[model samples]
Target chain A: MFTGLSAFPLTPMNETGIDEVAFTRLLKRLTSAKVDSIGVLGSTGSYVYLSREERLRVTQLAVEYSEGIPIVIGISALRTREVRQLAEDAQKAGASGVLLAPVSYQQLTDIEVYSLYEMVSKSLSVPLCVYDNPTTTHFRFSDELHGKIASLQQVRSIKIPGVPNELDTAKERVKQLRTLLPRDVTIGVSGDPYGATGLNAGCDAWYSVLGGLYPDICLGITRAALAGLSESADNQSKRLEPLWQMFQKYGSLRVVATIAGMQGLTDTPNLPLPLQGLDEVARQELKNILSILKNEISLP
Target chain B: MFTGLSAFPLTPMNETGIDEVAFTRLLKRLTSAKVDSIGVLGSTGSYVYLSREERLRVTQLAVEYSEGIPIVIGISALRTREVRQLAEDAQKAGASGVLLAPVSYQQLTDIEVYSLYEMVSKSLSVPLCVYDNPTTTHFRFSDELHGKIASLQQVRSIKIPGVPNELDTAKERVKQLRTLLPRDVTIGVSGDPYGATGLNAGCDAWYSVLGGLYPDICLGITRAALAGLSESADNQSKRLEPLWQMFQKYGSLRVVATIAGMQGLTDTPNLPLPLQGLDEVARQELKNILSILKNEISLP
Candidate 1:
């Protein structure tokens, strides 16, 4: 079962194309921090903007850099065929799992939604993680649907955004889901700052976008929690509060890339068209926060 | 430039996979109709749901059936890279043009939107048609962005859905677009039953989802309008009234597929997951409407 911190690494793109050098550095940082798993080509990773070749390359690089650590590949696509192909690619690249978001454009019926998961799961050999980020997908997976998807032979986990208002509801649903799903299957929380409470509420894993830049702090917190050192975990969480505040201030995508930039994982904090990087003032603020966090944690 | 009817054929799927026989038959029907052009793998064609291979097969079949007739391939994908690759495939398949919608999931910035069009247009050798179906893409192309895309070297046309409140605004925008775009560059209005006025308002083409099922009626209306026979055009418009109402009642995606089913195009109205087919009652009603139109037009 997945537990502790899963870092969604930022995709680096320079004028020449995907910045593999920057990506290598980012991967080394995450692996060194000993994150439970590293997720690639997700929203924070700017998967939507990258071409199929780029996505495949990023997945391969993540697997390579993660060493023995599990690498979860995001296989979100507009069409099932493409998603299936990407899933196949991910498995071939040695990713431990694939994360899928349902087609976002149209509202799918319950049966349609179930079939999408079933088809994708059947097509793949690797364990599937159904990503339930309704904010981007626009279609929320109901508890009943979640239960049904969990029953699929290949689906071993679900990653849900930890929005506050829906936190309790998701918790209740996951609690019931635990009964329906196999004992080994995991239920993970995304949207980290808000997810801390959900993790405490018994979610099997906590996914952190901010962890891409501050893996040490994220790992520190996870290690503290794992060792049952509540006071130390609280201190790490408090120390990372300013960075989380920046995430809240900047949009999620921008903040994610900006954090990656502060960690020197990427140069420009560039996002694909429709999404832009943070302005100079915000960039500097993010840098300052990273500096403070590094000093406090004595992160190399 | 694209003044007549265009049939967006429904993709055929069977037990073995894409039903090439049914696909060929459907394409032959539209080609025999002598449609001004054929839009392959469009919304009416179930573009979003098909696998990359299925999409390519449908495009190739349409091109083969039409011989020299223009074929416009729909290129709507969540990832920009897939869109580029699809554009290349469309070009290789001998498609005359490619229609691209903005990146489906993310709310793109104006600059990102511009860059998407620029990149796709640059990648393909054929003329590109900018498709702005905000209903599905969830991202509206502003007049400024549309104008900028129109100005791109390879962009030859645009397809805008004619929603009621936005009709006049679309007309005014198209008027400005005409000035910015090349004289030969066409502006096509989708949502055809409701878009006749936009055609009259000077759009170069009327793209129809209903045309897939009712090519005879669509062609008749187009011919009448081109001949300046307003009364005849009005009569043909009246013939489409019932079917248009059914489209509104059944939901756009299902109704488009149902039209293909009614025309003996495909079995099972295969919508990829998330979109369901019409109920039996709606299907029967659609069949009845098509029967009436066929008899009225003396079409086989």
Candidate 2:
């Protein structure tokens, strides 16, 4: 289930509540693109910012709209009990797998984090993915800890932060981790700019932000890399460097929200308050970049 | 409202949920001790671990049982919308002020954080305290940002993480911050081990976890420091070094929960899951330390 491109869409929302119409449109777009899997309520979806009812509703919508694609629901929460409840809810909502990040308010000890994963894994009937997103969760997992968690029952995949930019080093890093994790536990890479590098370095999946929005282009890169066409994959990724630059500078969430809003895929105030869309200057730059990219390569 | 010894109690709970009897008793203890203010739902209270309904109920109870002593409610949340709602609910429940940490999942920008305070401040009728708790929130505040936030109309105090261990350095750090803040705004210090040093160094309030559980002894140190009796304040704080050692070794939250459970102030399973009480060895060490302290100083 965690083998290929997993497209994670934005859960557009405003003051009234979740933009159901906009969100449904996004789900249909991913299903139409035939991406490997659809990830709902991931970091890009702002799962932590939502209420339990809202998260469940989104999960149900994604499963219903994704047209048979496997659904992975992010179930990160501050409390272990809540995380367990969310995991159970997601599985009940037809989730193919669940992603759990050690979302913490207190500085969590290694033992506490281990216990969190251990306890939640027990309640899950479906596969579980260890989401190691230190940038957002602020909980870094040691290699030994990652190994310990991956060996747990129901643990089938590990979503690593990002691989090194250098192709050889990225391969070596992934190789080192491969030996630590169980043979069946797939290693998927996040941080979109290095998608080709990670895939070419032998990562099993690309858990990508760009894939969530522009599934066709991301699928093109993923299919090429997986088929041993590393040059084609790298070329396709290089062609989107301007977008990656904006993502690096303004953050992928804001950049993606900007695209989603400008493209009319979501409402004007797509992101929740305190997490606004890109400012005027950044928006203008993104628009200019998109125009240039459209001339260079195909864009939806 | 934001001065002197502000006791921050644990919102003890178990599988059945918040122990109202235990919580009410803790609130009464703070009121009886005549602490200058009561800080409910601060990090020690596990505010982020709870739901909005639970947090609101806790706030209402704290205001009710504090017997007219000022109450500062922790209004931190991942989303700004929730924080605003919590703040409004807290004020409606008769809280004197609110404390907001830029609680985040996505790493927040300086502008995003500043805008959060600005927006929430507009809706607040009561004063707000800038909770710069980097250890928990993982959002560090620059002096420039602190000056900007402290100047906001509703901002009445800045709860700094801690002062330096050395007395001279602690005084200089506080003095430097004093210059940055408004004349009317006060400065409170958290990180319980530094309570006496912070007070002696001119922090207007000691936001001590120890103060919440053992108010009489903490009050003695706070009062002595405020009266310029540095030696007495130091002596009082030093007498409890064994307790502080446990706090530094095992987090203050865990240490406090252990004590609360041992003294029968709260239920046995006081802390939320994933945040267990001290391990057996640590608990035994704590028990020995408490016994030593009881003989060394007057313990309740």
Candidate 3:
């Protein structure tokens, strides 16, 4: 079962391409945190924008720095064959598991979606985690469809946003799913800020997008929750609330990247256009929030 | 500079893949219609769903059947590098030009989007057509950005959907752009039904999704418009109204593929997943409309 916090680290890039120095600095910072697992090449990491060679380099960097920590590699593309190739590459890089999202362009049929999971899962010996980010992929899998995916032998986990409509239903679904799936199968919650609620609702694990920047605070909240200290977890969440609010105020996920840059993990919070980085006002607000958090939260 | 009717031919697939027989049939049907040009491996042709080799095969097939006809190949992917490679391949395959969409998944900044186009355009010897399909690509290029792309030497055309909001403004923008761009540079419309209106407004050409199913009808409409016979053109468009209404009912562009399948151009009207084939009722409706059109119109 999924437990503790999984941090999805950003893949640093520059004009020459993959910034190994910046990536190494990020990896070192993340490894120092008490995170349960690390995710590489996910949407937050800008996996889709990378070349095949760049993807491999980033995956290898994550795995190497993981030391003994589990690494879940993101393998998503517009074609199944390319995704399969990515999965193989991730496995070769010694990633503990792979997260696969459906090809975005062609809204695949339910049958094709099932086959996609089946093919990728079969290709790798490692456990497979389904990454469903409907906002980006534009392909939403119904709960019934996810039920079918959960039935696959190699599919050991699911990484989904903790949307309100499906949160409770997903909790029950996962419970029902566990009966038919392997005991090790886990349901992980993404979309931070709602992660604690999802964790309380019976998700196996919760991912922290802001954890790369504020590891101690995120880990504290996760630790409190795991210890069944609801009051302490609630306190930590409230203390971290303002920082997360900065993300919301910025109006996009790129704000999370901006905050990471403010914390010295990345050189610039630059996102590819038509998604601009945090404007000056947003960046100043983010800086103020970071300063307050630094004074308040105990270092990891 | 962009005007007239352009056909996007289906990249026919069989059990072995790349069905040259079906492709030849489609090419023959479209060429005889005297379509101004042919667009290969676009959304309708399932470009993102194809493998690199398959994309090459489709490009080669289109070039061969072009028989001196202009063929514009769609170059779109998550990685700018792959897009550049595809653009190069398209030019090498004897394509008259290339249509490029921005990198999918990540929300691109205007600068990043511009760089992507610049890189792709610079790598290919042939002219590049910047395709803006915001619905699928999730990133919309601003009029300012389009103007910048238009100014690029290799970027010789702009292909935009003929939606209401964009139609008039895009025409005016392109009109001003024509003066800044080369004389041969063109502005094309993707939405076929609105082609005549756009042509009259100032666009150079119209890319047809329906051309594969009813090439003669589309050609007749374009010919009538070119001959300055508005009533004749309207009558031809009226003949297509029934099928177009069916497409409107489905409320998606994928309906074009289903209509193609119904016309016996392909065995399956399938479009990946999430985009199901027309239901029995829709299929029956399409059959009735197509039957009526076949009888009413003198198709070549």
- DockQ of candidate 1 (2 decimals): 0.35
User: Would you list the rank order by lDDT, best first?
Assistant: 2, 1, 3
lDDT by residue (tens digit), candidate 2, A1-300: 998899999999996689999999988888999999988999999899899999999999998897889999999998988998898899899999999999877778899999999998988899998999988888899999999999999999999998999999999999999999999999999999989999999999999898888999999999999999999999999999999999889889999988999998998879887888888998999999999999998874
TM-scores of chain B alone in all candidate structures, in the order given: 0.89, 0.98, 0.88
Query: DockQ, per-model, please?
Result: 0.35, 0.74, 0.34
The alpha-carbon lDDT assigned to residue B12 of candidate 1 equals 63
Candidates, ranked, DockQ:
2, 1, 3
Clashing residue pairs for model 1: A108-B274, A273-B112, A274-B108, A274-B109, A274-B112
Docking model 1 quality class: acceptable
| Best model per DockQ | 2
- The stretch of ten residues in a row with the least summed lDDT in candidate 3 chain B is B269-278
Worst 10 residues of 1 chain A by lDDT: A163-172
Candidate 2: where is the Cα deviation over 4 Å? none
- Candidate with top lDDT is 2
Task: Write model 3 residue lDDT over A1-300, tens digit each, in one string.
Answer: 246788777776654588777777776767787578887888778787777898999888888888687888889887666787898899898989888888577555676678788777777898888887786788788877877888787888888766453446755755664565456678777877766666655667777677755566677778777677766776777777886676556533577677656666677844533345676877788778777877888632
TM-scores, each model vs. reference:
0.81, 0.96, 0.82
